[model samples]
Target: MYEDFGEILINGGNRGLGLGFVKQLLSQAPQKIFATYRSAETAKELLELATNNPRVLIPILADSTCEEDVSNVAKMVSQETNKLDLVINCVGYLHNAEHGPEKSLRQINANQLLESAKMNALPTLLLAKYFQKLLKHDQPSVFSAISA
Candidate 1:
Protein backbone atom coordinates (compact mmCIF):
# COMPACT_ATOMS: atom_id res chain seq x y z
CA MET A 1 0.00 0.00 0.00
CA TYR A 2 2.93 2.30 0.67
CA GLU A 3 4.60 1.78 -2.69
CA ASP A 4 4.03 5.47 -3.42
CA PHE A 5 5.20 6.60 0.00
CA GLY A 6 8.21 8.92 -0.08
CA GLU A 7 7.86 12.25 1.67
CA ILE A 8 8.33 11.96 5.44
CA LEU A 9 8.25 14.34 8.43
CA ILE A 10 10.20 13.60 11.61
CA ASN A 11 9.66 15.92 14.54
CA GLY A 12 12.35 16.41 17.20
CA GLY A 13 14.63 14.35 15.02
CA ASN A 14 17.86 15.84 16.33
CA ARG A 15 19.39 13.39 18.84
CA GLY A 16 18.97 10.06 20.59
CA LEU A 17 15.96 7.97 19.57
CA GLY A 18 14.72 10.60 17.17
CA LEU A 19 18.10 10.69 15.38
CA GLY A 20 18.16 6.92 15.28
CA PHE A 21 14.85 6.95 13.41
CA VAL A 22 16.29 9.44 10.95
CA LYS A 23 19.19 7.07 10.26
CA GLN A 24 16.88 4.13 9.74
CA LEU A 25 14.75 6.10 7.33
CA LEU A 26 17.83 7.25 5.40
CA SER A 27 18.89 3.66 4.96
CA GLN A 28 15.68 3.16 3.02
CA ALA A 29 16.64 5.94 0.58
CA PRO A 30 13.31 7.76 0.70
CA GLN A 31 12.55 10.46 -1.85
CA LYS A 32 12.49 13.26 0.75
CA ILE A 33 12.70 13.81 4.50
CA PHE A 34 11.94 16.83 6.69
CA ALA A 35 13.54 16.71 10.13
CA THR A 36 12.64 19.29 12.78
CA TYR A 37 14.73 20.49 15.71
CA ARG A 38 14.30 23.23 18.26
CA SER A 39 17.82 24.53 17.70
CA ALA A 40 19.90 23.89 14.60
CA GLU A 41 23.22 24.82 16.22
CA THR A 42 22.79 22.20 18.91
CA ALA A 43 21.72 19.45 16.52
CA LYS A 44 25.23 18.53 15.43
CA GLU A 45 24.45 14.89 14.78
CA LEU A 46 21.44 15.73 12.61
CA LEU A 47 23.42 18.37 10.81
CA GLU A 48 26.13 15.82 10.03
CA LEU A 49 23.59 13.38 8.68
CA ALA A 50 22.05 16.06 6.52
CA THR A 51 25.50 16.97 5.24
CA ASN A 52 26.15 13.38 4.27
CA ASN A 53 22.73 13.08 2.60
CA PRO A 54 22.05 16.56 1.42
CA ARG A 55 19.61 15.69 -1.31
CA VAL A 56 17.33 13.48 0.76
CA LEU A 57 17.55 15.21 4.14
CA ILE A 58 16.14 18.64 4.97
CA PRO A 59 16.58 19.95 8.50
CA ILE A 60 13.98 22.42 9.82
CA LEU A 61 14.16 24.50 12.97
CA ALA A 62 10.91 24.21 14.91
CA ASP A 63 9.73 24.10 18.49
CA SER A 64 6.91 21.63 19.00
CA THR A 65 5.46 23.76 21.79
CA CYS A 66 5.19 26.77 19.51
CA GLU A 67 2.13 26.97 17.26
CA GLU A 68 3.71 29.50 14.94
CA ASP A 69 6.67 27.25 14.27
CA VAL A 70 4.43 24.34 13.44
CA SER A 71 2.29 26.44 11.11
CA ASN A 72 5.33 27.86 9.36
CA VAL A 73 6.72 24.39 8.80
CA ALA A 74 3.43 23.27 7.33
CA LYS A 75 3.66 26.09 4.84
CA MET A 76 7.22 25.15 4.01
CA VAL A 77 6.29 21.54 3.47
CA SER A 78 3.38 22.58 1.31
CA GLN A 79 5.81 24.45 -0.89
CA GLU A 80 8.05 21.40 -1.24
CA THR A 81 5.40 18.73 -1.86
CA ASN A 82 1.67 18.45 -2.00
CA LYS A 83 1.41 15.59 0.45
CA LEU A 84 3.41 13.61 2.96
CA ASP A 85 3.35 9.83 3.13
CA LEU A 86 4.31 9.55 6.78
CA VAL A 87 4.64 11.67 9.88
CA ILE A 88 6.70 10.45 12.84
CA ASN A 89 6.63 12.44 16.05
CA CYS A 90 9.68 11.77 18.19
CA VAL A 91 9.61 14.68 20.62
CA GLY A 92 9.59 13.69 24.27
CA TYR A 93 9.49 15.89 27.36
CA LEU A 94 9.77 13.10 29.86
CA HIS A 95 12.12 14.85 32.28
CA ASN A 96 13.45 18.19 33.44
CA ALA A 97 16.35 19.33 35.65
CA GLU A 98 14.06 19.65 38.63
CA HIS A 99 12.80 16.05 38.60
CA GLY A 100 12.09 12.87 36.63
CA PRO A 101 9.76 9.85 36.60
CA GLU A 102 8.96 8.77 40.10
CA LYS A 103 9.23 5.21 41.33
CA SER A 104 6.16 5.63 43.52
CA LEU A 105 3.14 7.88 43.86
CA ARG A 106 4.79 9.79 46.70
CA GLN A 107 7.89 10.43 44.62
CA ILE A 108 5.97 12.21 41.85
CA ASN A 109 5.48 15.95 41.75
CA ALA A 110 2.67 17.87 40.10
CA ASN A 111 5.07 20.17 38.27
CA GLN A 112 7.05 17.35 36.67
CA LEU A 113 3.91 15.51 35.71
CA LEU A 114 2.48 18.59 34.01
CA GLU A 115 5.77 19.30 32.29
CA SER A 116 6.01 15.77 31.01
CA ALA A 117 2.43 15.85 29.79
CA LYS A 118 2.95 19.11 27.97
CA MET A 119 6.06 17.86 26.25
CA ASN A 120 4.65 14.51 25.28
CA ALA A 121 1.21 15.75 24.34
CA LEU A 122 1.43 19.22 22.86
CA PRO A 123 3.70 18.33 19.95
CA THR A 124 1.62 15.43 18.79
CA LEU A 125 -1.54 17.51 18.85
CA LEU A 126 0.06 20.47 17.12
CA LEU A 127 1.54 18.26 14.41
CA ALA A 128 -1.83 16.80 13.56
CA LYS A 129 -3.56 20.13 13.73
CA TYR A 130 -1.15 21.86 11.38
CA PHE A 131 0.10 19.05 9.15
CA GLN A 132 -2.81 16.67 8.90
CA LYS A 133 -3.91 18.13 5.62
CA LEU A 134 -0.45 17.60 4.16
CA LEU A 135 -0.86 13.86 4.53
CA LYS A 136 -2.52 11.96 1.71
CA HIS A 137 -5.87 10.55 2.69
CA ASP A 138 -6.67 8.40 -0.34
CA GLN A 139 -3.30 6.73 -0.38
CA PRO A 140 -1.62 5.07 2.57
CA SER A 141 -0.47 7.59 5.16
CA VAL A 142 0.81 7.10 8.69
CA PHE A 143 1.26 9.17 11.83
CA SER A 144 3.39 7.58 14.53
CA ALA A 145 5.22 8.53 17.74
CA ILE A 146 7.89 7.29 20.16
CA SER A 147 8.42 7.73 23.91
CA ALA A 148 9.92 6.17 27.05
Candidate 2:
Protein backbone atom coordinates (compact mmCIF):
# COMPACT_ATOMS: atom_id res chain seq x y z
CA MET A 1 0.00 0.00 0.00
CA TYR A 2 2.96 2.33 0.60
CA GLU A 3 4.75 1.67 -2.66
CA ASP A 4 3.37 4.83 -4.18
CA PHE A 5 4.20 7.81 -2.04
CA GLY A 6 1.18 9.77 -0.75
CA GLU A 7 -0.02 11.83 2.19
CA ILE A 8 -1.60 10.13 5.22
CA LEU A 9 -3.30 11.59 8.28
CA ILE A 10 -3.75 9.85 11.60
CA ASN A 11 -5.71 11.19 14.57
CA GLY A 12 -5.15 10.22 18.22
CA GLY A 13 -1.50 9.41 17.62
CA ASN A 14 0.03 10.06 21.02
CA ARG A 15 0.51 6.53 22.33
CA GLY A 16 -0.56 2.89 22.43
CA LEU A 17 -1.86 1.23 19.25
CA GLY A 18 -2.05 4.55 17.37
CA LEU A 19 1.67 5.05 17.89
CA GLY A 20 2.29 1.52 16.71
CA PHE A 21 0.44 2.24 13.49
CA VAL A 22 2.54 5.37 12.94
CA LYS A 23 5.74 3.40 13.40
CA GLN A 24 4.72 0.69 10.96
CA LEU A 25 3.50 3.23 8.43
CA LEU A 26 6.77 5.15 8.70
CA SER A 27 8.60 1.99 7.75
CA GLN A 28 6.71 1.96 4.46
CA ALA A 29 8.29 5.32 3.47
CA PRO A 30 5.28 7.37 2.51
CA GLN A 31 5.76 10.85 1.05
CA LYS A 32 4.28 12.60 4.05
CA ILE A 33 2.54 11.84 7.34
CA PHE A 34 0.41 14.21 9.39
CA ALA A 35 -0.23 12.85 12.87
CA THR A 36 -2.56 14.73 15.23
CA TYR A 37 -2.61 14.36 19.00
CA ARG A 38 -5.02 15.71 21.56
CA SER A 39 -2.26 16.98 23.83
CA ALA A 40 1.05 18.39 22.68
CA GLU A 41 2.78 17.25 25.88
CA THR A 42 1.74 13.66 25.31
CA ALA A 43 3.47 13.73 21.91
CA LYS A 44 7.05 13.94 23.10
CA GLU A 45 7.83 10.38 22.07
CA LEU A 46 6.33 10.93 18.66
CA LEU A 47 8.33 14.14 18.29
CA GLU A 48 11.54 12.30 19.19
CA LEU A 49 10.70 9.55 16.73
CA ALA A 50 10.17 12.11 13.97
CA THR A 51 13.60 13.64 14.38
CA ASN A 52 15.66 13.32 11.19
CA ASN A 53 12.59 11.94 9.40
CA PRO A 54 11.42 14.74 7.15
CA ARG A 55 8.30 12.98 5.98
CA VAL A 56 6.77 12.91 9.44
CA LEU A 57 4.67 15.94 10.45
CA ILE A 58 3.30 16.36 13.95
CA PRO A 59 0.33 18.72 14.26
CA ILE A 60 -0.48 18.97 17.91
CA LEU A 61 -3.42 19.97 20.11
CA ALA A 62 -6.39 18.75 18.11
CA ASP A 63 -9.43 17.41 19.88
CA SER A 64 -11.65 15.40 17.56
CA THR A 65 -14.76 16.41 19.48
CA CYS A 66 -14.25 20.06 18.60
CA GLU A 67 -15.59 21.39 15.31
CA GLU A 68 -12.98 24.12 15.10
CA ASP A 69 -10.15 21.69 15.56
CA VAL A 70 -11.49 19.45 12.82
CA SER A 71 -11.96 22.39 10.48
CA ASN A 72 -8.49 23.72 11.16
CA VAL A 73 -6.93 20.38 10.35
CA ALA A 74 -8.90 20.14 7.13
CA LYS A 75 -7.76 23.60 6.14
CA MET A 76 -4.16 22.80 7.00
CA VAL A 77 -4.24 19.68 4.85
CA SER A 78 -5.85 21.50 1.95
CA GLN A 79 -3.28 24.27 1.98
CA GLU A 80 -0.28 21.99 2.30
CA THR A 81 -1.18 19.14 0.02
CA ASN A 82 -3.22 18.38 -3.05
CA LYS A 83 -4.56 14.97 -2.15
CA LEU A 84 -5.07 12.90 0.96
CA ASP A 85 -4.71 9.17 0.45
CA LEU A 86 -5.72 7.98 3.87
CA VAL A 87 -7.34 9.33 7.01
CA ILE A 88 -7.33 7.04 10.05
CA ASN A 89 -9.51 7.92 13.07
CA CYS A 90 -8.04 6.29 16.16
CA VAL A 91 -9.86 8.23 18.87
CA GLY A 92 -12.12 6.39 21.34
CA TYR A 93 -13.12 6.32 24.97
CA LEU A 94 -13.73 3.32 27.23
CA HIS A 95 -15.92 3.78 30.29
CA ASN A 96 -13.87 5.46 33.05
CA ALA A 97 -10.64 3.97 34.44
CA GLU A 98 -12.00 0.42 34.24
CA HIS A 99 -11.22 0.55 30.49
CA GLY A 100 -14.10 -1.61 29.27
CA PRO A 101 -17.67 -1.32 28.11
CA GLU A 102 -20.57 -1.44 30.54
CA LYS A 103 -20.86 -5.04 31.72
CA SER A 104 -24.67 -5.10 31.68
CA LEU A 105 -27.74 -2.98 31.02
CA ARG A 106 -27.86 -2.17 34.73
CA GLN A 107 -24.36 -0.71 34.54
CA ILE A 108 -25.05 1.42 31.48
CA ASN A 109 -25.45 5.14 31.91
CA ALA A 110 -26.74 7.54 29.29
CA ASN A 111 -23.91 9.98 29.81
CA GLN A 112 -21.25 7.31 29.48
CA LEU A 113 -22.80 5.81 26.37
CA LEU A 114 -23.18 9.23 24.81
CA GLU A 115 -19.57 10.09 25.54
CA SER A 116 -18.40 6.82 24.03
CA ALA A 117 -20.43 7.39 20.90
CA LYS A 118 -19.14 10.93 20.49
CA MET A 119 -15.53 9.95 20.91
CA ASN A 120 -15.59 6.66 19.02
CA ALA A 121 -18.06 7.30 16.24
CA LEU A 122 -18.65 10.99 15.61
CA PRO A 123 -15.09 11.93 14.67
CA THR A 124 -14.98 9.54 11.73
CA LEU A 125 -18.16 11.00 10.34
CA LEU A 126 -16.87 14.50 11.02
CA LEU A 127 -13.62 13.84 9.22
CA ALA A 128 -15.47 12.60 6.17
CA LYS A 129 -17.74 15.58 6.31
CA TYR A 130 -14.92 18.12 6.45
CA PHE A 131 -12.34 16.52 4.16
CA GLN A 132 -14.39 14.78 1.54
CA LYS A 133 -13.21 17.26 -1.07
CA LEU A 134 -9.54 16.40 -0.54
CA LEU A 135 -10.27 12.81 -1.52
CA LYS A 136 -9.53 12.01 -5.14
CA HIS A 137 -12.28 11.13 -7.52
CA ASP A 138 -10.56 8.30 -9.40
CA GLN A 139 -7.93 7.27 -6.87
CA PRO A 140 -9.05 5.23 -3.90
CA SER A 141 -9.37 6.87 -0.50
CA VAL A 142 -9.92 5.25 2.89
CA PHE A 143 -11.57 6.42 6.11
CA SER A 144 -11.32 4.08 9.09
CA ALA A 145 -12.00 4.13 12.81
CA ILE A 146 -10.42 2.08 15.58
CA SER A 147 -12.49 1.58 18.69
CA ALA A 148 -12.71 -0.55 21.82
Candidate 3:
Protein backbone atom coordinates (compact mmCIF):
# COMPACT_ATOMS: atom_id res chain seq x y z
CA MET A 1 0.00 0.00 0.00
CA TYR A 2 2.83 2.38 0.87
CA GLU A 3 4.50 1.81 -2.50
CA ASP A 4 1.66 3.73 -4.14
CA PHE A 5 2.23 6.76 -1.91
CA GLY A 6 4.31 9.67 -3.09
CA GLU A 7 3.91 11.78 0.04
CA ILE A 8 3.30 10.82 3.65
CA LEU A 9 3.16 12.36 7.12
CA ILE A 10 4.06 10.70 10.39
CA ASN A 11 3.28 12.44 13.68
CA GLY A 12 5.63 11.76 16.63
CA GLY A 13 8.23 10.24 14.37
CA ASN A 14 11.16 10.80 16.72
CA ARG A 15 10.96 7.52 18.59
CA GLY A 16 9.16 4.27 19.36
CA LEU A 17 6.84 2.73 16.77
CA GLY A 18 6.67 6.03 14.93
CA LEU A 19 10.41 5.98 14.42
CA GLY A 20 10.22 2.37 13.38
CA PHE A 21 7.67 3.26 10.73
CA VAL A 22 9.89 6.02 9.40
CA LYS A 23 12.80 3.63 9.08
CA GLN A 24 10.74 0.96 7.41
CA LEU A 25 9.07 3.34 4.98
CA LEU A 26 12.32 4.84 3.77
CA SER A 27 12.70 1.75 1.62
CA GLN A 28 9.23 2.24 0.12
CA ALA A 29 10.37 4.96 -2.33
CA PRO A 30 7.98 7.68 -1.19
CA GLN A 31 8.98 11.05 -2.65
CA LYS A 32 8.69 12.78 0.70
CA ILE A 33 8.07 11.75 4.26
CA PHE A 34 7.09 14.68 6.46
CA ALA A 35 7.93 13.59 9.97
CA THR A 36 7.01 15.69 12.98
CA TYR A 37 9.09 15.69 16.13
CA ARG A 38 8.41 17.45 19.41
CA SER A 39 11.91 18.80 20.09
CA ALA A 40 15.47 18.65 18.83
CA GLU A 41 16.80 17.25 22.09
CA THR A 42 14.53 14.25 21.85
CA ALA A 43 14.73 14.05 18.06
CA LYS A 44 18.39 13.57 17.37
CA GLU A 45 17.91 10.30 15.53
CA LEU A 46 15.11 11.69 13.42
CA LEU A 47 17.17 14.77 12.60
CA GLU A 48 20.05 12.57 11.55
CA LEU A 49 17.75 10.58 9.31
CA ALA A 50 16.54 13.78 7.66
CA THR A 51 20.10 14.97 7.27
CA ASN A 52 21.12 11.72 5.66
CA ASN A 53 18.18 11.73 3.27
CA PRO A 54 17.45 15.39 2.85
CA ARG A 55 15.49 14.92 -0.35
CA VAL A 56 13.22 12.25 1.10
CA LEU A 57 12.81 13.11 4.78
CA ILE A 58 11.65 16.36 6.36
CA PRO A 59 11.89 16.84 10.10
CA ILE A 60 9.25 19.27 11.29
CA LEU A 61 9.28 20.52 14.85
CA ALA A 62 5.75 20.44 16.22
CA ASP A 63 3.70 19.55 19.25
CA SER A 64 0.75 17.56 18.05
CA THR A 65 -1.28 18.58 21.08
CA CYS A 66 -1.02 22.24 20.09
CA GLU A 67 -3.68 23.26 17.59
CA GLU A 68 -1.65 26.20 16.36
CA ASP A 69 1.30 23.94 15.64
CA VAL A 70 -0.89 21.45 13.88
CA SER A 71 -2.40 24.19 11.73
CA ASN A 72 1.00 25.59 10.92
CA VAL A 73 2.30 22.15 9.96
CA ALA A 74 -0.58 21.68 7.53
CA LYS A 75 0.15 25.09 6.01
CA MET A 76 3.82 24.25 5.69
CA VAL A 77 3.03 20.94 4.05
CA SER A 78 0.60 22.62 1.66
CA GLN A 79 3.41 24.84 0.47
CA GLU A 80 5.49 21.80 -0.48
CA THR A 81 2.87 19.42 -1.82
CA ASN A 82 -0.71 19.71 -2.99
CA LYS A 83 -1.72 16.35 -1.58
CA LEU A 84 -0.65 13.82 1.01
CA ASP A 85 -1.05 10.17 0.12
CA LEU A 86 -1.10 9.06 3.76
CA VAL A 87 -1.12 10.59 7.21
CA ILE A 88 -0.14 8.36 10.14
CA ASN A 89 -0.85 9.97 13.49
CA CYS A 90 1.34 8.12 15.97
CA VAL A 91 1.19 10.64 18.82
CA GLY A 92 -0.09 9.42 22.16
CA TYR A 93 0.23 10.24 25.85
CA LEU A 94 0.07 7.41 28.36
CA HIS A 95 2.14 8.54 31.37
CA ASN A 96 4.83 10.98 32.42
CA ALA A 97 6.81 12.02 35.47
CA GLU A 98 3.76 13.47 37.17
CA HIS A 99 1.20 10.89 36.14
CA GLY A 100 0.98 7.14 35.69
CA PRO A 101 -1.72 4.56 35.18
CA GLU A 102 -4.39 5.00 37.79
CA LYS A 103 -4.49 1.94 40.01
CA SER A 104 -7.97 2.75 41.28
CA LEU A 105 -10.81 5.17 40.61
CA ARG A 106 -9.69 7.39 43.47
CA GLN A 107 -6.30 7.84 41.85
CA ILE A 108 -7.75 9.40 38.72
CA ASN A 109 -6.95 13.10 38.88
CA ALA A 110 -9.11 15.41 36.80
CA ASN A 111 -6.14 17.50 35.72
CA GLN A 112 -4.21 14.39 34.69
CA LEU A 113 -7.20 13.10 32.81
CA LEU A 114 -7.47 16.37 30.93
CA GLU A 115 -3.81 16.26 30.09
CA SER A 116 -4.18 12.73 28.81
CA ALA A 117 -7.12 13.71 26.63
CA LYS A 118 -5.26 16.70 25.30
CA MET A 119 -2.42 14.55 24.04
CA ASN A 120 -4.27 11.36 23.28
CA ALA A 121 -7.37 12.66 21.51
CA LEU A 122 -7.11 16.35 20.59
CA PRO A 123 -4.34 15.95 18.02
CA THR A 124 -6.40 13.72 15.72
CA LEU A 125 -9.25 16.24 15.73
CA LEU A 126 -6.93 19.15 15.05
CA LEU A 127 -5.10 17.24 12.29
CA ALA A 128 -8.38 16.40 10.59
CA LYS A 129 -9.61 19.97 10.95
CA TYR A 130 -6.48 21.49 9.46
CA PHE A 131 -5.35 18.77 7.04
CA GLN A 132 -8.60 17.51 5.58
CA LYS A 133 -8.00 19.54 2.45
CA LEU A 134 -4.64 17.94 1.82
CA LEU A 135 -6.04 14.45 2.15
CA LYS A 136 -8.67 14.97 -0.57
CA HIS A 137 -7.89 13.34 -3.90
CA ASP A 138 -9.50 11.49 -6.80
CA GLN A 139 -7.26 8.61 -5.89
CA PRO A 140 -7.08 7.07 -2.41
CA SER A 141 -5.62 8.94 0.57
CA VAL A 142 -5.77 8.26 4.28
CA PHE A 143 -5.83 10.14 7.58
CA SER A 144 -5.09 7.51 10.20
CA ALA A 145 -4.97 8.17 13.94
CA ILE A 146 -3.32 5.37 15.87
CA SER A 147 -4.06 5.53 19.57
CA ALA A 148 -1.75 3.58 21.83
Which candidate ranks first by lDDT, i.e. highest? Answer: 3
lDDT on C-alpha atoms for all candidate structures? 0.86, 0.78, 0.91
Provide the TM-score for each candidate, comma-separated: 0.89, 0.89, 0.94
> How many clashes in each candidate?
0, 0, 0
lDDT by residue (tens digit), candidate 2, 42-71:
888778777757546655568988888999
* Better structure of 2 and 3 per lDDT: 3
Cα lDDT tens digits, model 3, 14-128, are 9987898899899888899999999999899999999999879998999999989999999999989999998889999678898888889999999999989999899899989
> By descending TM-score, how would the candidates be arranged?
3, 1, 2
The TM-score, computed over Cα atoms with residue i paired to residue i, of candidate 1 is 0.89
**Local distance difference test, candidate 3:** 0.91
TM-score between model 3 and native: 0.94
Q: Which residue pairs of candidate 2 clash?
A: none
Off by over 4 Å in 2: 98-100
